[model samples]
Target: MIASPSTALVTWVLLTTPAVEQPALGTCSMGIQHLEVPPVPREKLALVCISPGQTTVINFDADLAMDSMTLDGAERFTKVEFGASTVKLIPSEKLRPGDHLRLTVRFKDTAAPSSVTLLLGVHVAQAVPFVSVLRETRTVESYQQELKTKNEELQKCIEENTRLQVESTGPGGLAELFMLGLLSDDGISSKLLHKNFVEAPTNALSATGLVSYRAANRAALMLMLANKAGMAPWTAESATLTREGKNGMGLRVLTVWQPRPIENSAEDSILVVEVKAPDDLQGSYTLKLWEAGGARTVTLHGVTFPAP
Candidate 1:
């Protein structure tokens, strides 16, 4: 004989609900979830909520090896697709609510916590649609790796700074310019600007007496700026030169120079910016300068340097 609707509902609920007991080592939740793989492996299993016939996608930050996956009760899953960094699976209707299946995978890399294991628990009323798993916990090996990377980057920066300082210490004038590749056969081409070339949205500083110079692939700009917002002294900290438009290029800024800070007592200060281009640097570029504390900024659009 067929069972009544109420009886079937009760049976389904009973089958899906876990027996009242102590909580497991790992936590499980419904909806989207984010988890971190532990730096040290333990006997506790990470748990994830799943519903029958619903697909749960799990994403990993690192690449996964295809052959390294080991799923318990794999035959009970209706669908399972594994990719390089993702796994999607739908539990079969035969899986009871209290049933827990294990899924384990190994990463392709040699990082610590190289493998992860998850316990997929069937729930009565809830299922996790997506789960993002990250291996952010740093182990001793990971700390050593990070230190090695940082040391390499620092060495590169030190070498570059040393080279720049050596070039800058030479005698001033034509020899200095030649040493830095700022001189060409056409000499230093210069253009004077008397009118306002400062673009809008830069009212914190008023720029005047602007001039642009070009030599080979190098460009320079000299301008006098007065801080209208006299809250703090303005000192140039950084500068950039970018071509305007959809596919415009960005030139590397070599240096930002100023004789002194622009304060209320000293309203105006001379500012200079030098840039290096990969090729002959011509055409108009958008120049942006920022103060020491980044409280004030100035942007000059259509900054055209004289032809070589």
Candidate 2:
């Protein structure tokens, strides 16, 4: 009864050769691993890969993610595009000579969940032609700024000239001149009148020609004197005439005056008139007169004279 037990046994066999490991999938080699394109004129570069069938994903450095690259603070590229095993780098704009570009590339194996990352560097060189272009651009900009400044100055000058013209030709301009002792009815007497009416006449007057003076009358007298002196279209400086109170003699007028000569040429000229007023008729007056050396004859209209 004790010897009735049964047992089962298993046998094993040994092999002499070892098993070989399978190769990894999605292995890639770069066709255009590095880049060295002229940055100037050309803004784009194409990066190609030898393994076209494999899926490719491109990643850019954080610093290089900008719309454009910069060299010495100048923008170089505006955009970037990635394709299957190919990447296109669009430049921001034309590059200059001596500009530098630095970029980092990381190649990942998308097919495998666990893959090693391959790092690559891309560099683009600057060209001589683009340097010249940059220099020319700078020069042109500088010239443009200069021209603008000069144009502004010229415009200011033109405006000033126009203002002076208006003041000299406006209303009461001739009367003011007359009160300053710059006008008279007599030709010879008008020539001798001083700018200051206070100065006593060296010679005795035969008669007082100016009875009641008005701005219109002064203008007419100026035209007439110009005609009589054989000088057509006479002109005068603008002046401000103010009534200083009447004395024992007549109405007193005050103005600071300077004598100018009338010329026969078409060029604008100031006619110097010398005349005498009463002793008390002199003081500072508000008047502005411009020397019309090269200006045209100013038309007389819409002038307002001060109340006497």
Candidate 3:
């Protein structure tokens, strides 16, 4: 069923389960539907993508509510054209690119995965990333300073005798933990559980965007460092394109994203920096990188590594 809550057109179908999945974490891919941007009834649904012309069959479970749902990224969808399960998209014509939609109710949800089936015509390309004007504004420059402060505090307050674990998330679904005082000063090379949760539009051409790239770099560095060739995954890595500071303390992201390779001609695509914590040190460890120069470090807090 379809309903318009935001005054923005919405379309919906009923389901009985709420199992969100992603591959790396053993979950399914997140699409316009998975994110609940389509404003469907909150229930369990197993959606199959049928592009152009394809038939789909859905089984409903129990009665579900269609009033409150999450569809924050709908603007990223140009055409959420429905397909034919037992029913097809109303308009025989394909929904065009940049087409705005208002979903009004259309499906009735029973508490269980019902025999009700639906087909949607989904499209790729020309969809803008969903960004609300009300979204928090951030200046890239100030981010590093914030990280530096957090890094210092993180290095303190938590040790083996008092080790505190802090978990955080970032763009592209980035996640990792900050462990204070867990390594020998000589063994300082930050390694831990880490993974980057990312969603690229089928319409997306590059995996390199401003925020995602920054988050990716952070994830990559944390993963690489923690792996130290092989330790554990760095689960909570993050970055800012415009962080503050001057040396390693003030790391920032470059504006130029990685583009497709052309010839071997010299092409300086801006610059990126990586921070490395000092080994065997007991102070607050921060790895900072600068585009114009090399990465630097700072001693702010203390730590307590385990015995050999």
What is the lDDT for 243 in model 3? 20
Per-residue lDDT of 1-308 in model 3, one digit per residue for the tens? 11112101100000011111111201212112212222333354323333221222222222224442222233443333332211122221243322333332223443222222222223221111111110123335345545665666456424211311122121111112113222233322222112222321221111121111111112112111101222221221122221223321222221211122222222212111232223222222222221111111111111121112
Separately for all candidates shown, the number of backbone clashes (residues 3 or more apart, or on different chains) is: 1, 16, 76
Order candidates by lDDT, high to low: 1, 2, 3
Q: Which scores better on lDDT, 2 or 3?
A: 2
Query: Each candidate's root-mean-square deviation in Å?
Result: 25.3, 44.9, 22.6
Computed on alpha carbons, the lDDT of every model, listed in order, comes to: 0.67, 0.26, 0.23
Assess the local accuracy of residue 255 in candidate 3 as a C-alpha lDDT between 0 and 100: 20
- Clashes counted in candidate 1 amount to 1
Which segments of candidate 2 are over 4 A away from where they belong?
1-138, 173-308
List of clashing residue pairs for candidate 1: 16-97
Stretches of model 1 off by over 4 angstroms after superposition: 1-159, 265-267
- Comparing 2 with 3 on TM-score, the higher-scoring candidate is 3
lDDT of 1 by residue, 1-308 (tens): 11222322322222222222212223555335667787797688878988655678999989998788898888988998999999999888667657889899999999978899998887632467788787965346545655675677578568557646755565655565567565578766667755546574734677756777666666667776777654677776676577766545667566676667888654467676766655656566777776543345677888876665
lDDT of 1 at 149: 58
Decide which is better by lDDT, 1 or 2: 1
* Two-way TM-score contest, 1 vs 3, winner: 1
